[model samples]
Target: MAKTIFITGASRGFGKLWAAAFLEKGHKVVATARDLRSLDDLVNKYGTNILPLQLDVNDRAADFAAIAQAKQHFGSIDVLINNAGYGLFGSIEETTEQQAREQMETNFFGLLWLTQAVLPVMRAQGHGHIIQLSSVLGLVTVPILGLYNASKFAVEGLSESLAQEVKAFGINVTLVEPNQFATDWGSASAAVTTPMPEYDGARAWLQAAASEDKIGIPEATVPAILQLIDSENPPLRLLLGKQGHPWTRQVYEGRFAEWDAWQEIAAAAHGK
Candidate 1:
């Protein structure tokens, strides 16, 4: 079935690809970017099927207004892809307070505001799907991506709670934890901090290990997203890419093992 899908950050990267794919599949796409002019290619290719709008996810009022315009234009939004976040690369100590806040504002709070705006429309219609673009770092920690990790971790928790809360309204939420893809995400969409000598070794090693040649195909994410949307019982969390699954499993299993090892100590604290 052709549905109205709204995607943020649709000027480039995964957002642009998703918009193109959905339009190709005969779906109405409301594609939004900070600069409307950047979406010229999408507009040209998809024509009337694509509604390109200017939206800065950091702006709370603009989020509501953009969503309102999208709903008005499309009549209803069946799927909302909150893909308007960027990566902030720096250790916790290296990242400034302002940087951290800005990261959360776009990646976490922005998603929350947009979701809030769309919920009423979906509630009234009694059906909708909200797809959150998270990262594998949301589940496991890395050296230089502390702020980005924290932001995605917040998305993970928020989406899980939202899924449980909105199930009664026939609204589904899915958190997509993707591994590195061959997109400009690491370059264009990332905010890098000034380097500090203290963390130079680890940071350098990580950077050297992250070769551009290793990035997976960006289109690989589309099939998983489409399957999730079509699913009658969509999972709350969907880890994309082969690397994400194994890495996530390892992290979770290690944590579980540690917890089990301390089970006696943990249980004793609960009772006399």
Candidate 2:
């Protein structure tokens, strides 16, 4: 079946890779980027099968407009992939108010607006799959990537709730939680705050712990993503890399141990 997939941030990273994959598979793609020119090759190669649009997901009006345009162009949208987000690399103390606001605007609010815009369309059709691009940081935190973790964590919670709410409408939601990959997330598409001297030790520790071998290849995720979108029963949450499951398990196991140890105190605190 040739499905129509509406995806944001299709200029690069996993977004571009997946867009090309779908087109190659004879599916139609409405690929969006902040800069329309970034999608020139795809537009040229795929021709009528691909609609390259300029979209800044932070703009609520633009999100609605883009959805309308896509719905008008393609009779129906089979899938919506929220892959537009950038990383904010900084400690909590180093992060400024403006930077924090901007991160939330694009990462959380942007996805929220687009999802809201697409809901009516999906409801009318009575079928759709929404794929949210989250991160391993959403499950477990790292030292310097605080804001990025916060944004993904927000997506995780929102998508979980959305999955339940839309199930009766025949709309499925899936959270794709990817670990570190060979993507532009940390380099080209990231914002870095001014370094504070107080966090130098923590920065050194983070740097020392970095391992290039652990980074998964971005291209490897396409098949899994395609399989997910094609399935009649997709998971509410899907972890993308080898480390995501084990790493999250360890983190949660510790949480469980702590909660169990303090179970008596926690129960006593509940007043009748």
TM-score of each: 0.96, 0.99
Question: Which has the greatest TM-score?
Answer: 2
Tens digit of per-residue lDDT, candidate 2, span 84-127: 99999889999999999999898899999999999999999999
lDDT value, residue 115 of candidate 1: 94
The CA lDDT of each predicted structure is: 0.89, 0.93
Clashing pairs in 1: none
- Which has the greatest lDDT? 2
lDDT by residue (tens digit), candidate 1, 1-272 = 99999999898998988888898888999998988888898788889999999988888899999889999998999999999889988777889889999999999999999999999999999999999999998999888998898999999999999999999999999898888888888887889888789999879877886777756898887887777877878888887877888888898999999999999999999998
What does each candidate score in C-alpha RMSD?
1.3, 0.8
Spell out the clash pairs found in candidate 2.
none
lDDT assessment of candidate 2: 0.93
Which stretches of candidate 1 lie above 4 Å from their native place?
212-214
